[model samples]
Target: MASKIFHPIFFILLIFIPLAPIGHAKRSSPSDKNSSPFNFIKKLKGCQKGNSTKDIHELKAYLEKFGYFSYENNAHAMDDDFDDTLESAIKTYQKNYNIKPSGIVDDETISKTTTPRCGVPDIANSINYMQPRDNNHESSSSNIHTVSHYSFFPRSPKWPSSKTYLTYRFISNVPTYARAPVARAFQKWYSVTQFSFEQVPTNQNSDLVIGFYRRDHRDGFPFDGPGGVLAHSFAPTNGRFHYDAEERWSVGSVPGSYDLETLALHEIGHLLGLEHSRVNEAIMFPTFSAGQVKNLHPDDIQGIRALYNQ
Candidate 1:
């Protein structure tokens, strides 16, 4: 309703969740088996101003994983140093997520980073890190990621045209309030494409199953708890959409709460076979504000249409 405000605490609740890599379950950071990957975010909060620690190195790796920080010899970049470039990248990341650009890794920063999210990254470089386009129209730019319009998947996968209507079911304990928010996301996609979503019974082998999950919920990418990733969906026809049950989810533009509907729009783009945009204003852009109201931007609409030929 009102223009969403950005208080320090306003964004602390919004975590930057990453896309879970689709494959056999992957290994987490080299921590004790009993520890959560999210612990790295918490430990990062302890790094003092103008200092470096093991946790800071891990934080750099985490940011690099999503196309944030990079060095030519990244092999040794994680050797525990909170240098100027790393701090700049961290500040850029904070600014992107609507967090104050404090540059120092504080409890507030780690608090947001600790949440589990979709396995997908905000930047879709070379289509799945190393996978490239057939034509080679795009070249690698600076380490910083930006919107490259009308992007496709690593292999550019999509659903067949004949099968237009996709069945989506709510699995696990999706609350009553969550229904409309989730439905609105589906409606937004439907408006832009020939695709329509049908809600079916849970665990009924539908095309898409929407639900909340906790740590190590089978698909290799484990949930790291409340501050890291928000939700992730599989590439088309796989039909698996999962949200982190641990997040403080809210339906609308509420401070200190995740706008699930906005996230749904982003994840659904991934489901329909689109990649992250280089255009920051596009919905597919990697980072999103916690309290902002967003519709599909013109660039986002263009990207989707380009993929589906709508």
Candidate 2:
């Protein structure tokens, strides 16, 4: 190898010239209120199949992260091309969120994309629980065919029949004030379901556990700071529910702050083995906006009943 030395003039020129960015620009994390991961999606609004841009790569990654992209499209995830797979994924996402499913990134789609939501994948194990389906398998009291949007985790796993009285404990990091809202959330579930719940000591082993975490906390799913993923929970028997500690959580109807009790209610539903629901009114819905509050819908009630054969 040969080594070359720059002249004094070259050094002077280097000082005067501006250097281009080394690689891609630093992307803002979800918690960044000014710019979120979905900002790229906003730039992609009106884009469809055959249109290509560097921003499409980010959109593909977002879809893949939420289980919208298929395995066969993995090779193209990093590419900027918007192909058939990308279009199909968008359509599925549109359908799941009750949009027109035109397969184009439209204003409505972009609006939904920007909202804060749960960390649970809308599609799990290749199953899209958000897809609308008929409730024919279950023995319903009515003869009319009913459309169901609520779903359960794969295999519909639930607490053992012998374990209806489940106990839960809040980890040490959970604040004292947050405990009341969480307890009320459990009471909401107990009001409708046959199962009962009791609180246990944090050190004692309990049927379920709850805590607040920020960023990557060793769990496979990490909290996305203040604005992105608000919380996530594991499926039945593996009762782990977590909240993003960085979020502005409130028990009252405060603007710009997420109601802790509302989110806790949703996570508790997931703790009971329910997956994301297509019904926007249901607590199992994947997305939740700040300052919004919701209770269990009929779909949620029917889902829990069907899962436990209550």
Candidate 3:
């Protein structure tokens, strides 16, 4: 197989950037009828680069929390002015979610802003994983030939080759009902990858740990109640996965409740070093809706295989 190369422009990402609080979501579907974490954004819609509103500061903070705003921009994040920096960040965010890069708070941008998403930033450490990558190689095994939307954390971290089989355990405080759905999520991943998973006793240290917590759990990355962030996990070798206990989570399709298995698959992808995919159908897509059940897309398969050289 020919060695595949990603374009240099696609690989650059900042490191050690601080994370701010991302926006929240509506309690229900995309119908635009419920409480939103970013309801303030709706009022600021149509505002652009020279416009200023007291709510603009909230918008600035929203962008900063999700890895769109830069450190230098913090000086202006507290102010109500919509400056050039805020416009730039909005453009980047718009481009990320496939909204037009108008740099204005348009209806489409507002809709995305209010959607429930993972706590992990779409552009973690300054790497906008939502950007598409050119995949020109013909896999000798699968013979896939096409562009890909899958991406990785900064430096593409992963589990060591020697540790093909991993043991995972739920924290003692995790809800009893969440275990089965989460376990099923692990089974789905094992079917696609060159790895196997085993559930171990909580008393034993395992390769991965899963838990649920409410606001400010002290993990550096805090949960933002019922709607905003569903869950988040670290890149490989960290193995800490957390779900927001405040969410209305269920094992199957239920109105106003997030499907546990679907989100578990997503966070597990992060645990395995896969970043958010721009392809909306892919489970790795940054935002997920309530009562939604998503399966692994081909882009997800291609990405993981490419990452581990499978």
Candidate 4:
């Protein structure tokens, strides 16, 4: 499992200057929001000028993360010079990110690469967007049930009764804080279900395994660059939840932050055989924003109940 190489230029910029100012200050700048497709290729070409031998591992890692690799017998190749291979990779990355696949890096692509992977913009103090709307009745359209109805329901399997356990393993190392929210997330899932799920001892065989790594984990899905995608998972067959450790994960109630616990809950849902929900209010929705909590909203309950009725 290698990470995808979507926006290599943006990532390199971040590393060289962590606090460097954005070139454009106004929100309306054309380049501020769009990024050209050839940005990474151009950068790679520039870097190659100074150093003849370049490490394609970084680019290879990026491609693997976003579910794009050689399909023919699982064999893949990386081009030393930004050639046809690079062009194809760019198009694939653009398609996944919802950008135009013109094969020319533009400003909009850059914006998407830099913005936080998930979460809505905070407009509390700004006079631009209006305040949040309120409805007397629970938002029916926002209801999770609206989306759960269409998920692929998995047959209930016999799970451990007393000692059902989940484990989180990092390929190299993970921050202590990172593991904490994931544990809390697992607990949140356990609270709503009849099955009692708990964290097993560090070295014990586990019912579910949660893995965190940069690139090339056991399963196929690899990680993309830092901001493009947060993480992905394998369904019930493996019960593996892998998060990109490179991401700046948030774990608490914040006005404009990505809650780690919330993400874990969503990924865990996938592990349990739940698919992305069409309902915006559902936690299982494919895209999430800041201020969205990870708890099982009523709709999630309805969907889970559909799977296991007690």
Reference-based lDDT, each prediction: 0.65, 0.78, 0.78, 0.47
lDDT string for model 2 (1-310, tens) is 1222211111111121112111232323335465444566778878999998768888887888789965564668778898988899999999999999999999999999888898889888877878855542343556866566788888888998777788889899887667777887888888788777888889999999999887799988776555678889999889999988777676745556677778998999999988888888889898887668899888888888889888
Q: Whole-model lDDT for model 4 versus the true structure?
A: 0.47
Q: Where in model 1 is the C-alpha error above 4 Å?
A: 1-53, 67-78, 81-118, 122-148
The parts of candidate 2 lying over 4 Å away from their true place are 1-32, 72-75, 134-146
Q: What is the per-residue lDDT of model 1 for residues 129-235, given as tens digits with 9 covering 90 to 100?
A: 22223542332457744433556676678998776777777865775566666777888887777777767667677787887787789986666655567677777
Global local distance difference test of model 1: 0.65
What lDDT score is found at residue 238 in candidate 4?
A: 68
lDDT of 3 at 260: 80
Better-scoring candidate (lDDT), 1 or 4:
1
How much does each candidate deviate from the true structure in C-alpha RMSD?
11.4, 16.9, 9.9, 14.8
Better of 2 and 4 by TM-score: 2
Distance from true position, residue 176, model 2, in Å? 1.5
Tell me the deviation in Å of residue 194 in model 1: 1.6
Off by over 4 Å in 3: 1-35, 71-73, 133-145
